[model samples]
Target chain A: MDNHELFIQGSRVPDRGPDGDLMTLNMGPQHPSTHGVLRLELLTDGEEVASIRPHIGYLHRCFEKHCEKLTPPQIVPYTDRMDYLASMNNNLGFAVACERMLGLQVPEKVEYLRVVVAELNRIASHLVAIGTCGLDLGALTPYFFCFRDREMILDFFEEICGARLLYNYIWVGGLSHDFPEGMDDKILRFCDYFEARIDNELNPLLSFNKIFIGRNAGIGVVSAEQAWAFGLSGPSLRGSGVAFDLRRDDPYSIYDRFQWKVCVGEGLVGQLGDSWDRYWVKVLEMKESLSIIRQALAARPKDGDVREAVPGRVKLPVGELYCRTETPRGELGYYIVSGGGNLPERVKVRAPAFSNLCIIDEISRGALISDVVAILGSLDIVLGEIDR
Target chain B: MEFAELLGHIRAALPGAVLEEHPEAFSPWILVARAQLPALALLLRDDPALDFAQLMCLSGTHLPASASESDRLASIFHLFSPRHRHKLGVKVVLDSADPACPSVAGVWPTADWHEREAYDLLGIVYEGHPDLRRILCPDDWEGHPLRKDYVTPATYNGMPLD
Candidate 1:
């Protein structure tokens, strides 16, 4: 069957009249704006998109199947590969799930350290989101500025754990290693510098750019009802004016202790849940993450063992649990079923981007072909999680 | 309301729908017959007191061969109510011989790709899924990989495996 028949099965295809101007366009298994190997088949009449079908699985490495083979602790590195930008949060979600199953209580220091690293990773992930989003549109300078600030966060990550990109730092019960000497000072310094830059430099340059606002604002608006029905979470859901944040509403770990605002899109420049609203939410969230980091740093205990509760082997009892955490993109849930064995019977990942990406077909219809990239970048999907 | 109270309300609404309840399980779940899923899902979403609008996750599993029942394949739906701030798990056991269950895509549009993914990996068919093609694996690939009895083939096209 052809692409149209495959998507709109049993529906009659519209005729193109005498000019015959309708065409099907493939937007990337390789295009830079897609953020990874995502192929969007667009049915277009000239410049307007009639319908869009997203073809994924180019990066499917069988993550869930791999989890069934590996032990709980060994699966940390694999979770890193899902949403690589938010690896720490992914590790924390899996670690929290395993810890719940094993009934292990980690030290106070582990909790503080987890919050610190996860908040930092949240900033880093948003940097990539805002940066690439600017690039997806015509603005290029913001990408460089955003990446430059993001490098400092990566430097802190590299100092704490040996790996920069994918750190298996968060073990089942505790952490892989405690912070290195003077690392706390470095993190605080970076937070101070990063906050200033985000407010002064990044916002003025890209977030408030008239051209950027014109290109993004009032485009691809998802109503709160549609967003909730589609199961869009995190910034995407909040962008549509839903105030649910897993960190606050769900309240797992030490998130309740921090004083941070849940930023919801208010249609400041355009309609609520538009492309610009989603972009602005990320910008505002960076500041909220900084506040969370500061609180975590202040509350961190100086003298405590990070690896005190790290078990030699993680053997879960006969049970199952679905644990979810607020990652940068949305809610990353790990539905783990154990058969009283070291290896999980099944590990189903409810990837945020997977659900977030599915709404593209619904939203992209009737939009100009150029706004497609803007809408996609605003969603800030990492195909790693989508295809995993 | 507590999970037990929620289950009680469901029992009142749809009699004989819930086959069993496992309150002691880690997450606490209810098993529903395959025929009762669509009705239960509708009641779960539309009923204001038990509004489970969000279908958080849907997973397909292959039961171990040693299990007593011939209905070995299962699909689990994890539902959450953003309004009520409650969660529920609805499970349906399908016979391995003919692994099929009524699709809840009509109740929750988010289940479209998820049911497709479940059908792709574990071979549990969602009876009314609009497009039930393979999601992660190639469309023409043989056998569901996540089933307990599945064996890796030695070769694919010209590729060889040890």
Candidate 2:
């Protein structure tokens, strides 16, 4: 089978238009749809993308190198900068790795509260993903609706931990601050409101829009076998009809207690593993995040010291620990090698976006240039994490 | 399969390649011969009983020379099986003089970028990588930045860094 037939069963554009002259097109380092400094060197035969070679590292900060120089606790802020959209998730992954290395168990209240904030951030991150994905397809209305709803999450994050964008609230031993008084009730209200907004306003406005569906459906299809081979996780894996979730499968933190469905894509408006399937998976995941947030809020203990287990000085055991948490995008893992010192011997971040971004060349081989943008938007990569 | 069973299976498959196994650690890790990395990786992916299909993370670290051991560069691959819900770590420690690892990019296509990133930062050469060019760093950049003794370049292209 040719590349076009491999992607879709009855693809109309089977022939590459009689082997047209190949043209090289550079998309982004600044393009809005490429999403944050990611440049794709697209080899195009007329409009169909012959292949895509993505050039990353415009945001490389050497996070692991910096981790070696700093103490374990000091590394939390650096983790925050990675995947800046899901900073709390990054903080939680690193904190879990450090706590595991130190053999530190946090309080019940801390566990409950950590779940709350992490889930909240998940919704916030997904809101940006769905919103920008809409904008990529030229739907102006949902972009505003998403940002307007997302501001509520940003406000809640700011109240909990002073920063709106990059909150390093989840510390290694425990949280940096208490779950703000009455904050739980406010998030509950937002959850109820956002659930309705997704169904009534955003869904009709962007997701089912005919032009948007036409653009995304059957575009840049990635098969399940290819997804596993490419090492995709999070929504990217789930989008391909795989029921692999670290929260469900791996059971990290207090996630096992909460009852939330892992929303694998069901080909709501397109072929299985199409760009539309991937995009819709993120939308369905927001509902699951809401369920998790509500459950975490209800089950959270009335009171306990948030920072009860905070160490004065750090002395970690000499061992390697690989801890992975389910971030909004995918599995955020921290592979830490501690050497019985204040500083870590090696800190390697298994960034979700880094792997998710690598699949472009595979799927974009026979897609239109515009479909490449839609497919990339569906992958939902944050270059901050990719280049870290 | 348990750690011992998997280790036994791997040992049976490639007896010469299996160096050591850490059963008591946080995760089941195996230290493998550097040259046998591709074979080990292929087995880990293809063997139905030990199906570790995903290369979740690939990291490279530089270890300073100690009293007992010489300077070495280590490449660690974290593998996971979605079907089995299990995890295993494979590590290869390269000699300091010529740090080269046979690329597992063929086993896991995702390892292509990971190996390039490792090559970019730590200078552990992935010998069989199709494109082993520096990924995070520019082609003109000198000296691997993640090595223990690496010094920050004061200037690049006549522009002062500090």
For model 1, how many clashes? 0
- Over A1-388, each residue of candidate 1 has an lDDT whose tens digit, in order, gives 2432233222224444568577899999999889999999999876678899889889988898888799988899999999999999999999998888888898999999999999999999999999999999988999999999889899999999988999999999899999999988888888888889988999899988877887787778999888877879999999998898999999888899999999999998778899989999999999999999889988899998898889998998889898899999999999998999879999999999999988898898877777899999999999899889
CA displacement after TM-score superposition, residue B137 of candidate 2 (Å) = 1.1
Residue A154 in model 1: lDDT: 92
- How many clashes (backbone N, Cα, C below 3 Å) per candidate? 0, 0
RMSD of each: 5.4, 3.0
Provide DockQ values for all models, in the order shown: 0.81, 0.79
Chain A TM-score, prediction 1: 0.95
Residues A270-375, candidate 2, lDDT per residue (tens digit)?
7889888888898998998889888888888887888889888777788887889889989888888877888888888888989988999999888888888899
C-alpha lDDT values of all predictions: 0.90, 0.87
RMSD of 2: 3.0
TM-scores of the candidates are 0.96, 0.96
